[model samples]
Target: MGRNTRKRRTPLAAKVVAGAAALAVGGGGLVWANFHASAHEEGPAHHRTRSAAAQVATIDCPDVGQQLSGVPDRARGEVDGELATMDSQITEAYQRLATTRRAQAGDPRFVQNTILGPLKDRRKAIIDRIQLEIDRAGGRADDNLDQLAGCQGRPAEQPQNGDGQNGDGQDGGGQDDGQNQDGGQNQDDNGNGAAGPVADDFIDINDVEPNSRDSENGLAANGDGGSTGTFTTDCGVNENNLFNSDNLIAAPGVDNGAHHVHDYVGNQDNDAFSSDEDLANADTSCRNQGDRSTYYWPVLRLQDGTEEFDANELGGGAEGNVGRILKPAQAELKFVGNQQGDVVAMPKFLRIITGDAKSFTNGDANANSSWSCTGFEDRQVTDKYPLCPEGSQVVRTSNFQSCWDGQNIDSANHRDHMAFVQEDGGCPNGFQAIPQLQVRLVYDIPTPTVENGQVRNPYAVDSFPEQLHKPITDHNDFINVMDEDLMNEVVDCINSGEDCQ
Candidate 1:
């Protein structure tokens, strides 16, 4: 009966303990499930979705390179043909330059033409090459567009799991599909990446020369085919150096053997006697026919005969003799004869009167009237004749005699035939007493000799040898018109005053 009671207690205890253990296990499983579900909902899966959505936000229809693949290859072929033609033409130009040099040997003009002319042709060739490349690239541009359009037509795929199942389990995750599509697109983009089609229209190839030289590590040559020694290298470097310097020196010299001695005929000098004879002949031909006698005027002197009129005395006169002897009283007389035996009067005046003789006329109406003594009647005349004081007036001889006393004798009345005289104590109203006048004959009268029944003047007689008087036919006109005093007044006004008042 005691054992039955204990067994009942043990069964009850086992049931109670088993119930507690089941409850604990169930609660812990619930907690674990909740935590794992929350973690899955909040992590990388959410981030991946967001990232994928952002990537597809705005769809670019055609990528840069894909647009170029749609063009046909035939157009590219035409561009390639054009490039070939350009290359041929440039090659031919260079060959022609070489041929020209061979034909002309060392001619400088030919050498210059060969070098510079080919350079221009090569420049054109380079431009043509660049243009052809651009054309070929452009031909391929349409192909890119077709490829881009084809790519856009397909739908984007989603990411997949490693088991190759789609997220929806029916269409696979589409991620593997998308990656496959993207890989092909990337390859097409790379294949179509021909930059020449997209290059600027004015892309000049000359700029590439420096780039090419850099690629070769700067080992280069100058234009004239000489090594630059600086490491840079380019296509035209050696050619440029050769043409510019080295080739020029290698060119041959020109032949100049056609020169003749007759070219220097006039450069030779004749003997001295021959030159003198030619000069003498020229002088004889230019000689005048008249005045072979060489008449010289008498040399003037002071009354005391102390000083003779030398060339130095050409313009000197007594202080009171203002107009008595003309200013510039004497000049060397060289009579150039005309066709006849007489010297021309007007021409003689031109040769002797170095100063302005027209100023001596002073616009007097009488000066224009006549050459005789009658014209002198209206003009101012000097008393004591030509001898007058500075700024003095001359009166008629009748007036002079009227004012004269017999003792004083009115010495101012002195006159010669045509002009007034300054002699014998004749002094003008404003002047001091007159100085004396005298003459010293220069040319001796030729001794009469009977030659061929004719009397002739000796041509070789030595006379005074100092005569220097110049002829003055219009003496009254010169004296009455301008005087030294008036000239001084005009000169003074010009020097110290304004323009003529």
Candidate 2:
């Protein structure tokens, strides 16, 4: 039987306030809280408080790989290998998050932006592979891990493509579609630089879990299976925009900080850097939607000189020593929730990020997150990229959690204020759970064209800038700019067991 047990999490001893410094063992230095309150999200940062009275922030994960025996016949060996890799990565991701929480006791936003968000994104590949292999083996894995991995049942299954050319790439996309395709071609041979890695269009979301089988009627999975309901929207024509250099935040002063732009979506006039007020007041392409939440992330390229993404140094690469950055295509932001209870309006300034910018930096090679052909989302062999069947385009699917600690909307780590939705689709006790939001991005990227020339990763996720046109570096963020009324509507919809557009 596959089951998980929650450990007794101890509460915090007391709350800390901003500017009121505390002491450390044998150390006497002020605990700095470097937070600037945004107009809409004004309040003391979570670093100055805790989720509850004396409750230390903690994340729990079940013992993975413990149910390998459940893996069926033919796929057993592959499933076992993938599960082991998955279990190790899952453990590291969670342990790393826990360690981060422990280390950055004062700043919760740092924990959220720095730990929780990145952990979820980095774990995407493992989660997908596990699901695929488990299904191939004819078994079900731990539901919690599946959800946490943000693994949706998948778009719909596809027959194995590419003649099985995974990584042994002696042939990625084996179709030579790299050289030609039906208008949706995503290759770069202009000579400025070679095209990046090639990927498939999609993997069946239904193969791993069936939508009809969702535990609750209105509740949809938060990517993976769960008792949560979900809906997505494109902020009208304002779906994509360029960032203002003045507001830029990542990749410190490079090229006199003149370039290195990012692609944005959500609020209009959003720049590289900005405050909650600027984001809220600015116009949005999200026409009718009353809730004025702002969402944006880095943009990818098509490398054919058509799309933007022309920055000299993309948003990441903090560790340096790399030629190209890896990324995924598309970043969808939507509201999802419990079928029975409505999610309380998220606090005005709840800042959230879903992936780490510096994730592929230095030695932190992302194990499996990357772009690929349709029906081959789980394959990791970089070079053996699969070729999609006709009518399919490459895409990246990302998800973000929606539960928040009632008292603290903004934590030092950004995550302390929020937690993953529980297996029951409810927020944890005392924590204010909001509707889970999911981000799904689709790209026009065709098959890989620039074979050995500029291709860097043969076993990696989508890399960036150099390979911008290749649909790499997919990430997302959001700030709850909704006032009381609109938020209440969101809550009402969820509590009533309904579907939202």
Candidate 3:
């Protein structure tokens, strides 16, 4: 799209967008424009500034391939061989990715991530050294950067037959049955590829590097510390069943027809059809004692097989959530309370905001909402698909208000009823103070791999069914389902500043 394609934004937003765009190019490369901070209430139509400053993502050749450091001559053949393999794999994977018809068949990105993506990583490991050697030789390797990164031709430019599956660059004669025969990577519902996945099937932890910043005596920095009392929950194993065609979250009187599927945890019976009355009575899957809060979000599909979704209809990359890559599956939560003698139980049925469910990008919208790696709360990024550290959990933390207007459980904007804690993290006077809920969804997903150390295509909220799910702009609903007695205990725990699990 041309630069003119973007409608202008407010002055402040535009400035922030431009700066982020430049930064993305110089540091973390992003597409044409990057998301900047915006009001959570602002909708997606008003998202992303179409600034040219956003650099087309750049490829980062992997460093330390076999050797600690070396020049171009020693590894030219090895690099070339690797690149050829990548080209072939990219072509093959692209074909299957584009053609796979069923959602159960898996999204094309599944093939890219598992199959061809590894080739990109492998190629990077060797080429990084060659590029470094060239740089060390005093002549810049800028000219060769794209080529060495295993680009079929140029950066962001892959060999394309154009008619390939899911916009994959391959065409006729390249299509596959979407059967990932290598092993049990992302398998179909029928369990065709039932074997354990190969290394290529997982995200390359190295590609999405984690922020190792430690704060205060080597403990990972936390957004909410002992500076405030907290109410943490022991959200146990992922108990939600496989999301089938029936787990619909439609609005009142609405049907799940246009909506796509979403994996649900928390209250098993919770759905879009759920009401405050229905939720209050629903039992929960929480491992904690007497706490029956509900939590759910869009399910991330492995994209290994075909699903009931049709590719020819409103699915796929351009239309529906069809070709969308998914988030790792998991959710964790806690409630951060004030130091006030005793924090009161949050009113029942209070719908809270944590990370902006509408803030799809990691940039501007990330001022208050975004995903972060464990132990690094201060260094959150707006990249919807931020790679978490290997052996660590992918944490999505949502912070709710400690002070409520006391009259409304919900507001016209769904935000007016509550307010942020004071700069000192204290509740304001007049507004009835309640337990500040902090939901942390930690998925046990491996670090997703990146070819050329760049995120080529990031998923968004619209990638899923519209009626129910929103992409990375994730915000969850919670209806206090605790028994009256359990609620009192929670309030007592918070008010007394006692740590309760």
Candidate 4:
């Protein structure tokens, strides 16, 4: 039903080194182990060594899409199409890298010559086309796009966020020896399909320390002008099973723009080719007909060797994303008011993308989603997947950017049109506060067994194959389509400090 599973090596003796450096992967505070110590050593010494080159785990390429913020409106479509092609090129190159492990072991430069070299050449040509497209459309393109064409293999042990502290509000070096360094189970370098989601990517939720931080940036100075109202929308958790690999906001008109499957709720019509008119007139999964907005995010999967539809297709098993998909048990969509002042109505057809889909390599500048257990939500993580204890479920929460530029509905990079509330809980200059969208999803998953430095039946979120299915890469997308009357009603309700649905 899915791609052929690769053989996993028996884990070596798991050593407990107390307080080694833990790298925080994102701003959400999930610390990961950056130690290069080998697991196969029989030493009382605190450190072990493995071939650094052999630990090349995934591809690390610059995010070209995020950098093309100046693309002209007339050239956006073609440029976006080219960018999607670049993604496919990387996926194919990663597949080659995964299948050629034996060849790589035999020749040191096998990867550089046989994989990355060709990939860079292809990317360079695409960049040239993009530049020419912009030039023809009377816009100046960056002359140094070639710098973004070359990519290097990301080592498995690199530090996330380049910080020594974990994001869960604890010093990385303070964990007990019995605790997992990366806040997960033991270490097993081998991954499914020779790609990632290695055992170190998971952490016991109870192991994380409890800390409280403002989920939406900094706190307000005063509450005199704040809007304290709330609104709830009844959108079922994708019970209709609408799934696709397309992304209308980022890579419109290109199939499989996401390179991963997304669970869609709200608007029934959403795909690469769905137009704004099509969405406004389409059926919706939301109980309120006036709120025809669309919301979606990547689906989570259990690595339990079960096959479903699209198992062999692109963006699924073909792209190293295998296993049975897990549906969310509960989907809570709430719109809350700003902390410093009243929120205005969101413009119709406004698009927002919260979190970075490529944060595994692009760094955590835009990584905003957080993971936790049902009862332990006070402690949230961004990099490591939470291993929930019994009687608790896995939870993923996304709090969207609530500030709108009050001008364009969309931007070239798809992010400039929106901003997060400032630390003072007010919008930036020229921007106004809008109803902040908060998406909370809960999943009842069978916990994976991590024993003897190995994991079985581990669950992971869908990601680009080269991104290694890291939890830091989790993201969410939204489109506002509420009718004007309903939108105004929402604004009034929030301004009046009333909780209305």
Candidate 5:
């Protein structure tokens, strides 16, 4: 299937220019072009106009191959030079901002302090742009030159098969003279048939019976001595033809937990609670609570069975089974990914504590199960421990902590409790356990802030002052403060002056 099917295009002059630029920048050290010209004669040879021929003669064109060859090295050099210039400028600007900041620390007139803000942001943007340009030009030039080299022919591949010669000094395909006597069967020199149809080794299907001993029916009859017509085989059945409801039967011993009917099939154990009894009890318990959170605790059994808690009882109400206690040593926490974060439905928070000692106050202790107390006062301690906090009715595990908020529980203090109990082992089993909690946080695009309003040079003495309220710096700020137009103008000037050295 090998074929030369690719279409080719005529190489353009612009490509040549680009190739040359690539080669110079990638291979040569030169960053800029140098053109030499003599000064024109005063008064243009006594005001005499030159002819078109003279003008053409005066114009000089460089060798295409030479120019293309130097492009890679030249491009690389230019990129490096530009980066260096940008870096120096950024550094200088940063220093100026820093100096201004130190001198005008509290001056109301210099309200927008330049030490660590907008100016620094601008410097960062310029540096970033310069770096991007350098990488693009240098990489393009190198790639072009490599491609050009491949386009030129390299070497040819060799054939692998060996020459043919029999040990008897005769051609490998040659026949013996004695074998050609009759040639009725077209025999070879070795007396073997060269051509003609031969009899098949096995009997034909037409000779065998349609329901004979070799068929599936035959095999079944022979195995059990039963009539083949009595049974029907599934020879023609396919996956698509199988009906979901056709062969279905009520599972055996479903009432005594011998078998289970899955949720999709309209079984009682369709939800977190194993049976309708548990769900009814839980629903009744929460009915009179009037806007309080409720949970269904799934208690797995030893024989792959499950039990559920009465929600109303768990919440200590009179409508149903209340004050239903769970033994901590026997109950393990369950984490449902999608259901964890719903406040009205699950009403639980999930958090994960890191094993790093630096993440907790009891750094010296084993932190594998410890919780975090960071931002406990503000109820925002979930940053370090992403799971539910303690004292908020959390379900404890070997590696994670979960909690439930009942009666306006302080989420932060709960987090603190989880962290403390995990490290110190103060929380005990049978201490009024709450349903295990799980929570997840989702984020959108980042918010804009003053620091990001402009690029900042960290080392500058007179950079823009960072905004007090915001943490992140953004793209718009960098553009507004940096002189992008001026930078572009410089680039254009250099590009237009092709004759400049």
Candidate 6:
């Protein structure tokens, strides 16, 4: 189809829009064009201006990958590769956006002309390739794929503490200027400043309302005919240093697909290039060798100046995800039965991704980030990084979907084949209940101090540079490579209501 022949989008009609204020880049600072007073409450749309300078926190682009649910099977690989390329383009553009403060100050249109414009162009070309791949494979590509090419700058929310400072403490900077001594954007020692985890991102657990779901933090209460048993897998806490940025399930054959390092446990050979056969024969990290499933999630980091091996590499410090990689104090992997009824054995090689890696800009629709202080697991928060009281550890939890479509091992989005249980605790119509994978990761680190608008010793999960390490972007990945016999055993254990390891 010709460029002019393609359908055009109606303003922001089909875009993954968020927030009440749209950022307009100008005068080296971001201008807020407020369309509404707040995002949560209903209000009349009106025009307003804020004189206070707002940070151009991150770039927001419509998530093309999420919308591609019909790519032909034969075209999936190429489409995935192009999608990975788009991610790299965004990372590069974000880097330039973060470092070009002076240029932006001089040219009101610098950010648009220099950063987002080129990014859109690059993404446009890639989107065309994706469309071609799908078309050639006999699938009708979305006519509006080109509409998703345009990108915009998103402003970061201001700090919530009212006071932004260091107090009477040493380094007595008193109040934050939101800039470093050199007039550049203030950043962590590893240079993650422009990307994020600002002081407002952390909230003391005490302040969070206790609103967690009843089923969270543990297996659900048994229901009539439900499998009440539990099965636990002993996967070490990634002590063997199994780490990578590849996501074979989402972007196979593409290196650095995740754009952030992951702490891997379970299958020993999981990577972008690993085929099903390679995984089946790979070494195992689980105590039970019959289970060679791969489980991985973004590594957590302490922004305390210590440099990890990947500190200067693409997925690490160079991409604004710097700091010392913190090892988990405890890694608990459990498979619990569904509350509706017995769960069937999960298909071998099934791929599942829980949570949204881009939730920072993508919004929390798919976000499964469950963070809390160890003793206060009952009050889990999704968006804010939990501030643990002294002596308390931080906890990260991922509750995987327990329902399946029964046929496909995976889907175009890697999500359609799986589904979460319904409110009544039953699988949706046409879906079969399966063992729910529950992961709880605990970290032992120094409590971050927030005072005078300054955060000290802050810790954040690794993320796509554009994601800014937001707590809501936290996610987990899993691929079931368990042998059929072992899988059957798990099903049997759960149905029998016996706890087994």
Top TM-score prediction, candidate number:
6
On residues 1-501, what C-alpha lDDT tens digit does candidate 4 reach at each position? 221122222111101110111122221111122211123223442111112222445666788777777778999899988888788777766655644544555566776777778878888999999999999998999997777887666455565552212111211111122212222332333224234566677889988888744545322222446997878898898877888877889988876678789998898888878889989998898999998899999999876555557565566665656667888999998888887888888889999999988888788888886899999988888788999999999999888888999987888889988988887778899999999888899999988766554665678899887777889889999999999988998889888988899
lDDT of 3 by residue, 1-501 (tens): 000111222223223322322211111111111111111122332111111111111111221221222234444333333332332233233223322323313443443444345545655664565465566655345444434333211111122222112312112222224442222222221111111011222242335445533221112112344325555776554443523212122222222221334444455455535566766666666776477666544444332222323222222211223322344455556665654334556666666544432231111222243466665555444334455565666565555556777776654234556676665445567676677666566555445444432222222332222111122345444556677776777777766556787
Q: What's the TM-score of every candidate structure?
A: 0.12, 0.46, 0.48, 0.82, 0.14, 0.83
Q: Write the per-residue lDDT of candidate 1 for residues 380-461, one digit (tens) a residue.
A: 2210112112332212111011011113211110111111112222322433211111111121121223233221111110
Q: TM-score-based ranking, best first?
A: 6, 4, 3, 2, 5, 1
Q: Candidate 1: RMSD over Cα atoms?
A: 60.8
Clashing pairs in 6: 28-105, 164-452, 164-453, 165-452, 165-453
Which residue runs of candidate 3 sit more than 4 Å off their true CA positions? 1-228, 242-250, 257-262, 301-319, 322-330, 339-341, 360-368, 375-378, 452-472
lDDT of 2 by residue, 94-144 (tens): 223322322444443554455445544655566677667767666775555
Relative to the unseen true structure, what is the C-alpha lDDT of residue 69 in candidate 3, on a scale of 0 to 100?
25
Q: Give lDDT tens digits, candidate 6, residues 1-501.
A: 000111222212112111111233222112122111111112432111111114435677778888887778899898888888788777766656655555555566777777777778888999999999999999999988887887776555522221112111111111223343224433232124455556777899999888654553233434666898889999899877877767889888776778788888898887778889989999998999999999999999876555577654556665666667887999999988888778899998999998989876676667788899888988988888888999999999998988899998988778888887877788889999999899999999787777655566678898987776778889999999999988999999999999999
Better of 2 and 6 by lDDT: 6
Higher-scoring candidate on TM-score, 3 or 6: 6
Off by over 4 Å in 5: 1-433, 444-501
TM-score of 1: 0.12
RMSD of each: 60.8, 21.1, 21.3, 11.2, 40.8, 12.4
| lDDT: the better of candidates 1 and 2 | 2
lDDT, each prediction: 0.18, 0.37, 0.38, 0.71, 0.19, 0.71
